[model samples]
Target: MNLKKSYIAAIMVAALLLGGVGAYFGVQLAQSQDSTAQQGGNGGTFADLSEEEQQELIGSSQGNEKLAKVNKAFNLIKDSYLEDVEDSKLIEGAIQGMMDSLEDPYSVYMDQETVEEFNHSIESSFEGIGAEVSMVEGKVTVIAPIKDSPAEEAGLKPNDQILKVDGESVEGLDLYDAVSKIRGEQGSKVTLEINRPGVSDPLNIELTRDDIPLETVYSDTKEVNGKTAGIIEITSFSEGTAKRFDEELAKLEDKGIDGLVIDVRGNPGGLFTAVEDILKNFIPKDTPYVQIEDRNGEKSRYFSEIDEKKGYPINVLIDEGSASASEILAGAMKEAGDAELVGTTSFGKGTVQQAIPMGDGSTIKMTLFKWLTPEGNWIHEKGIDPTIEVKQPDYFYTNPLQVEEPLQLNQNNDQVKNAQIMLNGLGYEPGNKDGLYDQKTANAVKSFQSDNNLDSDGKIDEQTANKLQADIVEKIREGNNDKQKEKALEVLFQ
Candidate 1:
């Protein structure tokens, strides 16, 4: 498939990201949705229905008396409205109105262009900041930043409200329109004004858009207690994820590792069957890994064929950023596999959605089912809590300093206070982070300046502040100081 690499996703998705924005996952979980609109085996690519197909849809739509009133209103608006309006626009608007009435964020109407982008082959690369974002409560909110992407590097966090893109307010813009503004050519810079939770002021995050790779599984080895422990980090589930996971885990097993740790932090999720395949490696056939409930309230359970679990203990890492299919994996590991979960909590998204093509190039991705964990727990809005909760270091959540002016001795303000916090976190140890720059704070600043090869002046300037933030971000990314990761690895053997 010579599909163009999509630039944006719901977060280029898990649609494989609505920028590559947030969780627009593909559904192979329920094959019934794909049973419709079939065209030559590309998984639900049906369009321009035959006579029989059109009749099937119309027969289902017939005998709805309220639709007559809706049709009457549509005609009245078309014939008697004060201004000229295109019929296509009116129809699309009507459909959008219906979607809004449903009040489901994941259930969205995709136009032809968006539909094409949304269905972009999972095997392709992605471009953008690489965070899954959605319109939440009238504001475009970050669902989760893709691992190793520019969005993650720039510190974009889940639930972060994006107020503007490059100074333009996004108050009235829809998600796609806002995503268009956020997406850019690789190497181009985009500035996002973010209104994050618990922050007094909006943050200005500048990122250089880049290509997000298609690879979803990352493997490594951690030596814990003089024993080699395998660590598999699942950034997202995609078409090739399960195979990669299997190959990697087999290699780890070949090495005779004592235990295993699967990390799914900040994973917005991808294809359903992809996660299902991965679960088959851990979840036994005796119990169902996940259960799906349709609109009819009928339940269907899915189980793995494996009769026994792994030889060693296992632990899964999760946080508020871990969502959708990620939740499914974590839930299975916690319940079915009897593995401990480390980290704060999982992102509570237990619904199943499918993008059914409208036969007119457009598509409607609707939430069709509610997914429950193996124990039949519906964790919709309430996320799954970790068995052993752990948080990252304080510096990981430190506020980004927007120091317009230099901070010198005796200056009392937030800028000074923020710099002190950063310096303390970086091991400089400034006396009292009280938003006041004392002589000791100045010394700490001078020490940081000297270490970074800047002028050893006892003042926090623009260059100095930027360097501090960069270094802090680097430290946060290092995982050397990450407490959650430390706990996750330690719990593997304990």
Candidate 2:
């Protein structure tokens, strides 16, 4: 019985050993199948890839490789983060990073809430404080307040540095952020602390918000060299500006005006089409006026249609404050040789933006096109150079006009004297060469204009000097109405 028990035990041990070996081989086969399936699904294993593929796996691809690195870092944070993170905030940050990459002062990413507020401002007439704003020298400056607005009523002037809005510092805020903060519901009271040049201390003013009544066109008649010149000051290119300009032009013509001085000073542009229509009134033929280049390397040309009133001599005046549509118009007129541009270099603003509507009530204002001059010059970074440059006087041109006779009028600091010298050469008696543009100089200018038969506004400019030289029949003066047609013809040809 003992021997039989021992043999049975040995057989049982062999069966157990065989079973253990089979189980081990089965596990090895299963693992092999799993690894092969993983390789097939992912296309290849990490060990099978080349050096380039290895770098790509870690996101080292060229052409936006920086963005790829950022994306990889974010993914790592998401996958291996110790604490849970909000995906929405991360997404928002990514959007902001995208905008920051563009490095544009005007281009920005608006959060959903801010975008909603912006939409409300455009669609409805809700307002907090009314002021046109811009970023000048990296500071938030008030361009101009709307006429009859709370800002104007509160004695807010143009070029006022808005230091604070409702006690919030405007230091770090961009143009759009500052604008958004200043704009709010109508009837809401807001306070502004400003820092002006002439003011001794910071000026604090409190105002209540109201509707911003649109005043697109401002016109007046200034008598120059005994002839009435229509002076139209346009602050913006709104929907009503073109129609208003047309009406103003008709009124000036009816009043027997000799020349037109369109002042587009301190004008920030609005709509592109409105300025195009305005340009058509002066340009006679269907000519290319401006070129638009997009992000995708696509381009488009905007043309000026022919006008019936091609007889008018239009002189456009621009300054450092003129931007966007203002620059576009100036460039177009100068290229067409239809008008003379006189003033300082214009503000460089070449990009065209479009407010793309979201499914929600909000919108995203994205710069889509870059504006180009007719001469194919990009006005971005580099501003428009004036054909004729004229600098303003340090002091006002008052009726009595007392010149601040500097102790010594050196050539280095006597621009007025230089102007007088130029005028004297142009056959205008500028009294004594005292290096001053005073009342005597103004009177002398009037006398010169009277003798030359031009407008008697006492303002010596390129147009007036050119007219005086062209007539050559100096001292044989004629009425403005009689000389208007001739001057217009001269300007048209020039």
Candidate 3:
């Protein structure tokens, strides 16, 4: 369905959980309490009722034995607990317990503070390291770091499994609790022990939290296969991301680039509306973008309606970090024959969550629906595999770079080409790997150096060259290691 209708549904269902609880126990307790309070003053107890009256009360209360037992436990906790507990806390705890019983990770109860933080994270800036994270394979994994954010600045990469925060193991922590542990006051330092694939030992990295401004769409131009191509990287789908994407596409069209590379590498997805709006730019008018099946087995289809397509050959770059709205966009484009997907499989997250705000400033992010591609494919646990599977370099996990001779900018040799391949594989865009180092190549080298805690002088000295080559060799040793961008360019040029 459309976003407007979905929002209305969310508002209508905001009090569903509490209302259900109130229907079951709240009314009965209130009626019994009011009778006792009026008869025997405010300090009245259920003991005032005779045994027969208590049985009658239970009988009248829906004849549900479970409700009676729950009320018994509530009163017991209130009377015999060592510490006085607020009724609100007890009620919220009940709600949390109920949600936890569902055993669904996406279904959660947000406290007032958490609700506010969640809203702020989507709509505005927040104090954090700025990484999109989720529970992957039962571990808290970094989906992708936001570009230029503290997470990226600290060299955090996608698929990095967070093992500990401040030396505390997060083995049994939920996603929300893990995120809370990582986020703190701005300028505060947080240390993360990460277990990345292909690495034996965990690596500890410290990052300073910052007020991260949320920006989803970024664009630039890159030369591929002797042709200039537009590269639009969408970090995540946020509010107004569609508008931003349209503006960027317009700028790229004005440049008249040969091809377009839409990079949703580490994007963990966001608003459904944002994805719906952005998909219209590339897909044909009225083409089905995504379909959602609700609770009652009712299905709704979202379609694209842009009359004119960009028409440029499009290549979508994805990795394990790409999920949710990223999948929606990529799946739509691929199914519509509008783009060819490059890179590795996307992080599968086919369910849709509706954030319903409660009256008490708390919220419930419930997974209300499951989404499918235009071709009716369910990629929930099973990810969307790339038509061209290009694995990232193994050195990203191996921690060593290999090179023999020092390579500088403007050098034309196979060594420079190898360095370029290694750099691209490591997520550094060092122009084309034609064996000739250009200015973009130097800048990419500097960026890599800065990220790896080395000198950022834009020159590949002996030390830098060795590091780059070591990474390449490690990838080669891992077998079938080549540049993903190279395959992408080949597809676009073909």
Candidate 4:
């Protein structure tokens, strides 16, 4: 039989099986008819097929035995089942089963409700706790909380393993189902039981869901040793992220910053278009940013068209939370020699998925291609390791109780000793690394705070301690055992 004839014959078999069920199935057949019309006279209508012709088509497609088995099963369920089943439910289940058989996690069937939620997510406004989560190691793990979001306010941290949602265990649950349990109408309360890395006991955090307004680009200027550097943090590449990034970079340029740091530390990737647009700012025109390779070995390259490159030393910070479009941007920048990547290995997710709308209001997100860097490296399942691997400070995993108490002038303990050591590491000159919060130590703290833009209170509060530890880690990462802000500044000055 001709290929077109065989294809139409297959659809006819499906329509005939579902036609007697409901009006929805009838509508589906009508849509198929419309498609057949568009295809022209490859084969005549179902009415034109004689009984022998129909049997022949069905036999060619599935053989008589397999088709008989399917028909028998359908009739058995419909006639002998204890409960009445809806035709829509059966059709949906069959579709889901087909998708499940592929065994690809990224490819799935989205019902109408799921489609709406997916659209809302891309639009960047949703009623939720405002955290990007994913299934990691068989648990729902928080990638990051959006800046100024309810999740951030509730103290949700990166790599937090969510054990329960609203008093119900989320173990073995789908990531989307867990997310649905956590998300609700605005002003609704949702409780999360979190198991952090160092904490022995699970911490239960209560948060009020709100309408999250996402801001993808956050930029500020920092003066290091009298040299200015622009620090831009991209949370996610939402709809307006590219424009926001350009505007922020322009402001930094107007300030005449000597260096730039692009921080995508906990950014779960968003739209590819946003990442492409941002690449145009720093990559020279005609430079290939990324390549997409399809199943048939056809490849397409996405290139940059910016007239000029930014004349500044660039550093990119990424962690395990950086994925998808974030990896694309990072890979492009590193391949183009436009920036040096810092931090740890990034989250590997190089596959591309396209959401295709069905005739109904549903959608099917199918993995269509795999992305590669400009240098032709496929970073899927294997993340991109940074040039400089800077591990997070040990203090990051410490219990909040250990660091929450403010160390004052009269306090002398292990916490104070730790702070003094960090301060001395950063060249704060706190006299001694002894466990003593003396007047000299207090004076050193005040001086350090004055230079670092913190309040000159001469007390080691939570914020002060956190900053001190971060500065110490940064100093070590810069290859300086005892200095603040040396590596990037040296590169910029050179």
Candidate 5:
């Protein structure tokens, strides 16, 4: 029994002895009161003893049979152990055991070295081979490569299972150990062997680590439906994101863009103020953008503050990769009828994480709050489903970072054909919607790029594919078919 319970039991026993001959009835009554008091802390009192007597009563349980096993274990460790050990280490081990018992992948106790590394990563940016890795399905999978980082330059992609690090087998290593292997001094090289989906052989990549600059907003423009559509991929709501997004907006305006596509895929999310500032550029002042609800049903509303709406009918692209602050952006746009969400449902991580610093410099990140849309819908486990569902094109470009389990190639791979078909339907006229890519298709692709202010290389990269796969064209088509584009605009502005 624990010390608290032992002390309480001792008091009860003492009270029973003090009452003497007629104490049986009183003892039963006191026991009932004690049980009720323990259940809910009802300010219970034991009036039968003085302060000194109470202390003595509690001390009587030190030699009780209930504590015999604990005492014996302590004696054996102190007297018969082969080596002398500190009591503090044993206590720390016990604490570690308690955390292990929870069986939660996210929650873990960090030792000194781990604690220091985690703290440094959060504060000062470090040099490393930049890839977000997670222990998923009993293997370390690449969530995504940081843009322009060593991993991205080496062509790492999401969902690539890492089989080896620096030629060392990673079969039994934990997530932390794998991360440690990947991180090192700048200019140092690390090699990763990846096992990816739909690839023939295990892909090997050697990357030189570098200090990665974490930017929040990335933008590019492309042509669709004979019109220039400016695409901005927002990775996080960092302090610089609003200014970066505004810069992109100005560039798009200068280029006379006709449409906008916002990519929020694989965006882990960040600061609320940054999100609000961003919403201001797209939404009208006084429009509800997001809401936070507490367990007590008290809600706070966050509204857009822009006086004028500047956003062209926007299309927000999402997938199982987008999360947190990204959801806030997508949820707000969808609720306000400002943007049409395309692609798969998001990552469904709606809860807010707060880092509480311990007396030591280490901090514990705990999920303290949850986020909601302006409509007051909780987005915890249930993510926001897109108005238009589109899958990420799997066959357009092979993942060079890792080779997946061999596919039964006899099955039809239709992603390229799907892209061609979708591109044709949008009107920027790529040649014939044939499954095979030819010279005519390449010419049309170049024309589209030159007109849209893109790199004009005619090569369909992942970013280009992301834009093509979005639902902007489909949403526009649906509006045209219903003959409601004009009417809907009137209602929306009104």
Candidate 6:
């Protein structure tokens, strides 16, 4: 992001004023978190109001008629309960119920402990599986895993419902509680029983939690067909991201790259200002890069100060994992900057949320605005479209082959089908993926085993399945066949 003091301040003022929530875009929060624009956060509100204003608001709130029924219930529960209940607990439960009534997963209430954990995860990093999650339909659903984090490394996909953490059911638990269970000491093993969509049985995925790092930008250059393309992968938008992006971009430009590919495939998003700063680099001054709409439908259009677009082609890589600020950037680039987006549809998240602190340590994160693209299109629930839709190889989507019993010839089952998919992805074509363990599939399994230096048996045993999964994961990590990226380069030079 381009963080010129004057420009960043201007944008911050717009966000705070439109947010209409007390300066929850508080200076400390903005400075500390760079005003993260992710889907969730600790509290940032109640930081700017003066003592007099706070007293006035509190005094007025006490006499609010809208809360008459609520107060009556609160008093009844407090006075005539069979068993004693903590006043604080009842009050917090009320707050959480109100948030639940909104029916929006992004809005939530976090207590001090949760707030501190959330803040820690954003500020530096934390020891956990490293995935952004939400309470969707009463289930703790993964929004997306952080790039290169344990959650991603463990094959946790977007929308995977975490049914159990460490063999204990997380059903009926709030998003915070479920996530707390998922997090543990660094290097400790945590097993997640995941209810993946379309799978008949839940899979137990064991992951070793590690310290998730804070760095977001990764840069490299790819030489393809005589043209060098600069590739910048933005894992998330956070403090100093714009500066880092600028520095890396300059280095790429210095090397005389012919084209550029901006990869935000698994980026879950960060601060609004962080993305806004990055937009200024590519989007021309003539068009509004993003438009923020408030509760009353008041719109604030934000534009860059740049005179023109870059000379070389710009291609953005997006997939199901790109969200929020990532979507904001993708929308702006495709519509206003004319950058070609090469990948599948993105994760749709269009609302902007700001956290408001309660007098106590807890805070309420409320969705305050709906952001639209430069073309006045709201991609909430409906993702931004790619100019050239390119899908990765099937291996990228293949799940781990679970082999409880040896999958040998003549066996036909879902497990066998899954194994066939993996074998096919490994280039040992299993002839068909219809769940039939035919002679050809057995041959493929034997070939794969031999290649991995295992016994040349034509059966997919536990060891063979593990080896197959490990090799496929390693190939994916190496990106030996990233079809989407190849398409981006193809479009860049076309």
lDDT of 2 by residue, 1-494 (tens): 00000000000010001001000000011121221111112223332355366457634443565678777877887899998778767866776667656655544555667655544454324355655565666577765444445665465555688899899999977566777677666788888888776544576667787775456676667665566767677766654668988998788888988778777755655556567678767654445566666565544555554554455567777766566778888888888746777766876777755433333333333455577877778987567887767644311110111123321222222434544544564456767565666766677667777876767877656555444433322211222322322333234324
State the C-alpha lDDT per candidate.
0.75, 0.55, 0.66, 0.64, 0.55, 0.74
Candidate 1 residue-wise lDDT, 1-494, digit = tens: 01112222342322221111233556465442232212122222222344468447745674688689888888999899999889888888888888878877777776788656645623477667888887777889998877667887777888899999999999977677788788777899999999988777898989999987777777888899898889888887776779989999999999999999898888777777778788888888778888776665666677776789988999998999888888999999999998999998777888877565566787666676677888999988888999998987666777777777788988887667777878888999889888888989988988899988999998888899889988887777666777877887887877
Query: So what's the TM-score on candidate 3?
Result: 0.69
Off by over 4 Å in 5: 1-105, 108-112, 118-125, 135-139, 167-175, 193-206, 221-228, 250-258, 284-287, 293-299, 381-383, 391-397, 401-494
Best by lDDT: 1
Tens digits of per-residue lDDT for model 3, 441-481: 99999999998788998877767865675555444434344
Give the winner by TM-score: 1
Better of 1 and 6 by TM-score: 1
Writing each residue's lDDT as its tens digit, candidate 4 over 336-374 gives 846778777887877765444554677555556677888
Q: Model 4's lDDT to the true fold?
A: 0.64
Model 5 residue 25 CA deviation in Å: 62
- Which lDDT tens digits does candidate 5 get at residues 416-478? 444555556455565655445555555555665576666666655554554554433333323
**How many clashes would you count in candidate 2?**
10
- Rank candidates, TM-score, best first: 1, 6, 3, 4, 5, 2
Give the C-alpha miss distance for residue 273 in model 5, angstroms.
Answer: 3.5
Prediction 5 TM-score vs. true: 0.58
